[model samples]
Target: MLPRIFVVVLDGLTAMHPSPRIDRLYLAGTLVATSLLTACAVGPDFTRPTPPTATRYSPESRPDHAAPTMAGDAPSQTLRIGDRISAQWWEQFRSPDLDRLVRRSFQANPTIDAAVASLRQARYNTTAQEGFFFPTIQASYAPSRTKLSGNTGGNSPGIQGNGSVISTVSNTPASQGGTAPFNEAVIYNWHSATLTVGYVPDVFGANRRLVESLQAQSEFQGYQLEAAYLTLASNVVAAAIQEASTRDQIRTVQALIDSSERALKVLREQFRLGYAMRIDVAAQELALAQAQQSLPPLEKQLEQTRDLIRVLAGTTPDQDLNEHFTMASLTLPAELPLSLPSELVSQRPDILSAEAQLHAASAQVGVAIAARIPQFSINSTLGGNASEFSQMFWPSGKLFSLTGNVAQTLFDGGTLKARQRAAEEGLNQAQAMYRSTVLTAFQNVADTLHAIHADAHTHAAAERAVTAARVSFELTEQQYRLGYVSYLTLLTAEQNYQQARLSLIQAQASRLGDSVALFQALGGGWWNRGREQRAEAAPK
Candidate 1:
């Protein structure tokens, strides 16, 4: 958007008119820029890569087809190709607690604040560098009382006829430079006022390259900020799912303990009749203890998960959060948007960040090469100096000067060439890093797609296990009550049912967790965000 480096150079040429020396500088730049847009930049110019030729993410196009799942549990998720990813991807889960958690995290999170600050800093630096395109103009006033004597120079001011002789004598050296000399040290006021201007035009585009580099860095931080947001939102969703799974585990274990206790009572009644062995009662009691033993850790995990959510949303563990999540509270989206491989490079924050760094490195090579060439500058000072304050601006006592400067490195044991080579190496490194980041991004999306498909199948299996265990437990309960099954057999069925139920809860959570991961992997749809989602801004 700010490709005005050459435009600013033209601005210096047009406004306020250039001197003969300045005209040459402008003419040189205009001639070079007119030949080619990249004439000013010495080293290799940066070109954004074209999208990959492949139309699909996978060879078999894994996500182009719908995933398979069991009928009763989670349904198959169909990839909705060419569907625009929603900026509010998390809201697809339809959990208000999650929505609130993500909202609060964007506002109150310290990580977000730091990223914003970095973005702002980069913005200011870019702005400051842009200003270098214009001349630096300044004004100054200096008043002094100085002693004029035969030692330093000539006569003191106002020493002759009514300021007339003093003015004439000051402008002319006293006849042969020896006629008049100060007999004694006398103080006189010397007033001077200056209006000056200076400009260092971007003739070779070194400064402009610097500005380009800074703009890329600013964009880099913007992507980084987006990455922070994506990460925080994903973490909150994952933590919420974990909490729900932990709660289900605790609930299931409690139910299991209750079942074991009831079975133990029935066995005790049988023991009095000598129909049940003491070992049978002991087995039931041990089952009860084992189920109870599972409770504390699951409870601990639930509490810890809640605490994690609180911290993610920028609240202390002690702070009360009224919202609680359950498997029922969240809804899995039936359709997921899959970004094509060609578009993924632009959409992914990490990929874009790496690309921005690469752009900056490309600019750096220009800057280093320009440093080896001759640099030009123009300076002018228009001012006046007089013994009287009122006369400082008058034409009779005015002073003015103008100068053009050129600097070129003669030799530094090849230091400038070495730096240019080093910059080229750095560009190479950034290119490699950018390629790595893109590969990683593709892997992330592919892995998430596979996980979603696998999770649905896993949940399906778990659902079947849960159903079978539940039916077996019911049959065993009836048989034990009728003295058809031993207490130990009933306890075994009960434990199996409990484990199955726990697995089902975890599998259900996995489906939800996988959905969050998919949304993150698809770049969190940050491109649609038109403004900051919260009231936070970078500190000035």
Candidate 2:
């Protein structure tokens, strides 16, 4: 039926020709056959790179639980292997402020906005490329006045009188040429209307491959958007944790300064009563000054961390954030979800995005191969041209053309072949990059796991050290007052207590921060939120 329709159209275009009808039918059938030949794509089909075959992320077995510290109320965390991570993973911390801040960042962050815009752009471009699969039809109408010179060979547009041809013409000036037959110019109005149809039959699947490449690129952008969401959320959580940690450090240093000030006062009174040496008072004063000196940096760090939280929440530094973070305000998740090694390949956005890029590269190889083959095109114009608009569609004024073309690069100095080779190399490059992304992803998980494990032990040790140091410092302080120990011993005990207190605070924060890292390295559980939901969250 399609071939018959093509024959009919061809017959209408070439009606003035004395060509046989069978000849037109044969040509149409040949074009139909050519279109049918493009059943397969030219290059290798894409296959997802296999997931990692390893059973675990680390070489050695990980602990079932993190070591809990006795000094703080923070609980030990248990690792739940092959557990499903929630899409709202941050909620595991049970901090409403953190949850609200992360949500706000998702809505207002510029990075997320940029990624959304890129995804939309890619989708639009892919849709545009798909238009090539259909024939392009356009219609136009033109009306114009044209004049032809009489010098060209043609019959004069005048009445023939007697045996001699006589024509009426404008009077010739006597000065220019005494008496000469006047050359008349012909003027007429031409009207034309045409409907042109053009199509490039993808005889080698070039357009199909092109469309496939664009679709893969769009897919890549979608994953990039997911990556952006993951990164922004992770940043917000980490910044919040850092803010909490810095605040705790500041509080600890302030406590140390207060304790030292109290000690300095006691020493001054002892010296005034002639019960203590001036050097002892001077040493206590120096210790107090040192403790006081540490406060400013901690204060500065706290302020900077607050500013970072503000920015991460997509607000100016001058703008105050209503939500403030402190260690007491955050609850470390007791249960940590760990995905299997095989699941990680599909979980991480970077790995998935790399896979999409590889897919696009594979499609590009097909496109390049298709380009080396002969290209086919069919164009037809169904229109009429006449001197008057009323007669434009008359049979005598009908004008039409049907053309089928095949083009091959005969002598391009191997440009086509070189392009094909380049595409193949590009595919290889994508493969390498994909593998690199997978390796990096695995390394991230392994490193985070190790850090979490180490942080727990460090936290427990720091807590014990703080307890021992506090007891020693208190005992030494009383001994110094009772004339049982030197002021240097008291000072040494005080310094040890101060350092231990600070280390305990750091260890607590590390335990929390590394937990965040573990969640992030495990891909933030984005897959729990299906693609459609995530895409809908993007800005329109």
Candidate 3:
């Protein structure tokens, strides 16, 4: 056995004494007993909080129907309940650019790096504190030149010859000297080398509770790291999708501006020839300006979004992160996992993190309770002291001491009891927070589930609108070419097609984003990846 460090305080004993051999045996026995007793800690042990009793995420579950859209690349998605999520969930999108960007972000995001560092630091602290379970050993050497005390308290040290071990003048205080220890008759140099050992027995489990709290904190950091990973990946995906949608919108708006320009040219000619009114020509100009105005802002947003993606991937805004993404390139997975409500409790990082806080708080309560009880400690110093440095380790200079201590607070201003109560309250707060986190997680999943269901129908309607608008615009344009339709009728057709096309892109993007949100709400499958995988998931 790796020397178990747990020690138990024997209660109700004011003092005890034993020989060194017996002391060793007693300590060994106590260590073994305490190790067994500590199988139960002072406070309530942490049980993984039970998942909500509800069976479904939402009040009314809808079937995920496959509805085809304008783009063939985005396949219809279906919900797969109680299915496992892969560690590399982003790969389901099947976009090389998204895959590469997410991979890079895992390596480069500053928030992820910071969280990783914090987790490492917490692990170190917990590991370092394990030593507290064992006795503390320290070695010391102190050599000092000091005047001899009168002797024992009142007796003289006694006279000595020139070569005596006491010293040449190891006698009493001078006949006319000052009183007591301050009036030393001789001075000598003593070199002492001692090894000391000390331990505070954990009779009430205070030390164990402390270690438990630290362990919970470390676990909390681990979940926090997971949360950072989920947030960064989702953000990168959202920004990429938004950028692609805006690019498509810009193209559509530019085409509208071109159409407006053609109408304006025809109107100007007609106005000069006394066929079209100046008011009609002015309206065409205004329409063209409005279309032109839409392009710059979309262009600006796209550029800023691309820069944001680079930053998320841990690159400077100017760095060439070569990944280029578009809606067409992203493949919507046919099947998406919808975890059971119970599973989400284990999966979500924030909820798990809150649970960890609750664990820590519970342990703190135990520690507080232990503090109000009696404490026991033991220490020993074994070494040699000599008047001459060279004789420090000699038999004549040998010295040793052992001490055992017990302390109990008979009376106080109720401070310790108050702290114990405060710790209990903290536990309650943590419990409440954990519940709230779980509720919010369920809400997120419900919202995303609804969005995904509603988006399929919405995308279906948009596809039909685009198809109808396309047919109408083409016929109207041909009629205008043949001088059978007025400019206003052509303008309306153009606007209808543009509006339908843009709405389809928005719906398509919304569906994709909703998929991302569902993954996020379900904890992003961090458990599928081990700690090492998560810590290094980003681009190397």
TM-score of 1: 0.84
Model 3 residue runs over 4 Å out of place are 1-40, 61-75, 146-187, 486-492, 530-540
Q: What's the residue-level lDDT of 352 in candidate 1?
A: 93
**Per-residue C-alpha lDDT of model 1 across residues 268-382, encoded as one tens digit per residue:** 9989999989997887788788888889999889999988988888889999687798888888777888888788998999999999999999999999999999887767676
Of the candidates shown, which would achieve the greatest lDDT relative to the real structure? Answer: 2
Rank order (by lDDT, best first): 2, 1, 3
Off by over 4 Å in 2: 1-24, 61-74, 153-181, 269-282, 469-498, 531-540
Best by TM-score: 2
| Per-residue lDDT of model 2, residues 90-145, tens digit only | 89889999999999999988889899999999999999998887778789999988
**Cα deviation in Å at residue 234, candidate 2?**
0.5
- Report lDDT per candidate: 0.79, 0.81, 0.78
Clashes of 3: 3
- Cα lDDT tens digits, model 3, 1-540, are 314322222210112222334455565575566456545557677776777897887565543322222233234676788788876787788888898889889988889989999999988988887777778878899988866554443343232222344432333445656344433455666678987778776667888888889999999999999999999989998888888788888888887887788878888989999998988888888988888988999999989998899899888888877777777887667778888888888999999999999999999999999888777776766677666677666555556666778799978999999999999999999999999999999989888877887786788788889989999999998999999999768977988798788888888888889888888989998898875476688687
lDDT score at residue 166, model 2, on the 0-100 scale: 26
TM-score for each predicted model, relative to the true structure? 0.84, 0.86, 0.85
lDDT at position 431, candidate 2: 99
Model 3 CA RMSD to the hidden true structure, in angstroms = 5.7
